[model samples]
Target: MNDDTVTATPAAPAAEPESMPAPEQPAATGPGTPDPADPATPGSRRLLRAGAATAAAALVGVAIGIGIIKTQYDDPAPATAAAPSTAPTPTASATPYGAKSNGSHFGSLRDLLLPVPAGYRPGPDDGVYGNDTELNGEQLSAELDAELQQIPKDKRDKLRSYWEGLHVKATGVRTYLSTGDDLVIGLKLRQFNQQEVQRINEYTAVFTGDTGLFRIGPSIPGHPEAHCYLMPAPPSAPIDYLECSAAEGDLLVIMNAEGVAPLPKDKIVALFTLQLDRLARPGASA
Candidate 1:
């Protein structure tokens, strides 16, 4: 489950125009002309010749001028009348599950897609992981696990099953789990899910130091509605894990760790809450 191992679906390419030949021009005419039926007098013939020559010359001059104009201002080929630039049709931003919003502002996958959990409180660290920010994998996991342990064991197992189904694997132990309405927010939950899997694999490589196949489990208590993964760090370093979910009106997020330097419990709770707030905002889905 290394990050590099995760691949995204490719997008389509734009279309191109085909080449074609140019049109032929018409023959030029003179001012004066002689009847061919009559073997015209020399004078008349001369006049006719002169007229034809003049007409040809004039036509050439006009063609040259037109070429110049085309080169300077006009498009060479019949210009494609520009299609009216219709404004992009706006999509409805609000959904029954939540509101639409951007995920970029929030650091973690959970924050980017869902609203903060209700009755949530930070343990101690306010700015560290609590306020819309990132907590190291180890710290986040430890805090999350401690919270999830508070839930009934059966509930925890149900949550774990959900995550296991997704085959989520990281390099650490999970510490916390929480849920919110993400589908309604119009978040690119599918893309987020893919990225989460990739991130778990990446962290696994970082923790193990040596490259190897890592298997992630599914749902856990705190993230009952979402999927989870684990990747234990090397003995010398802290483990790292991540959990994410995108269900009808719910989003579940989880973090884990099992070593020194675990993320503060308060910050972990706060981070989840902030994510939910963003998801609940209007226009977030767009």
Candidate 2:
């Protein structure tokens, strides 16, 4: 039984030898082989990884540098010098009656630029009232109207109509009786007229009687010639005279203030005459 078994087993084919893994060979080193510790080495995985990391770090560094450069060069700071002050300039003060108040008569017309009349005591009214007359302002105006009534009917009618149109309300009428020292002075303010205004400006006087005749040339710098005359007064007062005339535009003005005591009649007449003469001189046209 042993012989048969041995023959049949043909000697279990010689046992196949188990193959062992070839011993690991050292990696081949070419001309550019890298060392694992060196980042610049080629063909070394550790070196390639380190190099990639270093390149990435360098790119990041460049970006940070560019940002810093831009920040430093782009925007500038604002100027810090102190700002200038802003203040208003001062102006000059204006003078009184100089281009401010147009010519206004605060007192008697004559008082504005001439010597005050002698014995001319101030009246209760701001305007001068004659001290020589018993008649107050109202009575003087009435007497003036009575005197005007003596004009020719047609002329009186025309004059009355004109005065009515003017809305004239007589303010005062008084006579200054001549007291040898002064001529009688009378003044009446009824209404304003352009012609009478012009005449007044020219200093022209109009008289209604024989002794009143006189010529007054322009006394002002520029004005037209003016004429004066004496008109009859009420018989009761022979020395009293009515000086009536047309002003600027048929404006009737009558002067009847009489001069007495310290004022001469001739002097009063001459004073008025001189005043009118001044007016007759040319004045600068309005």
Candidate 3:
């Protein structure tokens, strides 16, 4: 029932090799002195002189050749304009899923949540008055701080460090009741730093993987990143529940549905997909 169970699971780093000192550069040899390690003979010195003379002659010949080539271009031809390019100028690539260039939604996070369907009405208010609820960055941080008050100081410090790294921005919540089935549906969106969205998604998957009473809910068509989970009622319990979680851009989408046994999995998935589509293209969905 709480997305807070999803935490950062950082990968362990590989060990690096021990540092080694670089070998010293060889000392430069001067023209007058042959390297003492390998003294030059008289015949070798004479051969070196002849080689130097040949190199000087080659340099002179190259200079003369350059003058001849330079003279050929001395009388330049009239310049002509360049032909216009036929290819179209490139435009910036479209943003992924039609989100903003920076990968976050452009406006109110609540607006990004899926609208209530035809047969549903606003569900019971679990918060102040309305079915919708919101919390800003400071409010969220304060809430976490209140929850962490009972823990040891050292553990609190570490948890606070991880919370700071998330850069949590805001959260939005909405609920709905199906008139015919008395099913209660809840939706929540938590916005945070873009870099941590996928990490949160992975953590959610791991947290929900193969636990008792929890099974894979359903697949959200066209969205491989989104997942749904279902927890059926136990013999003593009468209500069944379905939950969906996805990382959409910088926002984490969470959905919950509760009703009698045999909860409508297709309905839950369809609702989830609609929500994702709205996020993918805000303007069109609006």
Candidate 4:
């Protein structure tokens, strides 16, 4: 599949008073003299009115700030027990979501037809596909060239190597709407026999080093003949991505799901299975 470096948090602000405390509760000097709370003195009344206005303004600012944060970071609601699903959860495991990936047999990776899930819709415009286009192509596309410039030159080679060795036979780029806009998924089918799959798995087993600006992640749950890795972006990059592949028959199917938000493990698996199911159905194009 197209290689994509995974994506990119901030510190919460301390809840201190946005405004200075009102004049440190002016000392009540001379009991008979004007007290700060005394309505009898116009200056005392003015201070009280000013304090009320400042407090009200601070409350308004806080409410607006919270509204912005929630809009930017809002996430899907947790799945509820009563909700029904054709997709069932599997026995718990050590994988990123404890998912038991589809172990069912399949004829070929080339036959699987990908489907856009419910919450996911197609991207607005045609988005160029690849892990990150610049890293995989002989010439970086205009957009990717810009994203790459964000990374330092010394780190470029390492990023290129992540997809440099992979042998891909075909690639399909599809845009989907999955709780967000322009979520791009790249599906790659590679030619790899049983022996080759074993060798590749062994190679990835000990392969640990700099991935340029990309962050390598742990293997996901179940698969037929390969492992899944959570590919994240360097702290500097703008988005996130995931890569999972396994040998199916004579072909290795690699999936690259990416967006500004990190996709859940189960959802990626769901998309994978959806493609496989499409391929399995009679007369359906993979």
The lDDT leader among the candidates is: 3
**Across residues 260-283, which tens digit of lDDT does each residue of candidate 1 receive?**
223233444344434434444454
Span of 10 residues, lowest total lDDT, candidate 4? 4-13
For model 2, how does the per-residue alpha-carbon lDDT over 146-238 read when each residue is reduced to its tens digit? 544544455335333433433332232232223232343444332333443443323322211221322122122222332333222222322
Q: Report lDDT per candidate.
A: 0.26, 0.26, 0.50, 0.34
Query: 24-137, model 4: which lDDT tens digit per residue?
Result: 111122232333243231111111111112111111111111121121223223211121112222224433211023322232322332444587644322123311111213
What residue pairs are clashing in model 3?
Answer: none
Please give me the total number of clashing residue pairs in predicted model 1.
53
Kindly report which residue stretches of model 2 are placed more than 4 angstroms away from their true locations once superposed.
Answer: 1-116, 119-161, 169-183, 195-225, 231-252, 257-266, 273-286
Global fold similarity of model 3 (TM-score): 0.62
Angstrom error of the Cα, residue 196, model 4: value is: 2.5
Tell me the number of clashing residue pairs for each predicted model.
53, 49, 0, 15
Question: Candidate 3, residues 1-286: lDDT per residue as tens digits?
Answer: 2221211122111121111111111112224323335432221221111111111111111111111112122322212212212221222443333367456875565566666788776665423313566677787677667655644566456556656777778877676667664366767777886666666565556545633324667888887777776643334333455667777788877776766546677777777788888777344332
* Native-referenced Cα lDDT, model 2: 0.26
The best candidate by TM-score is 3
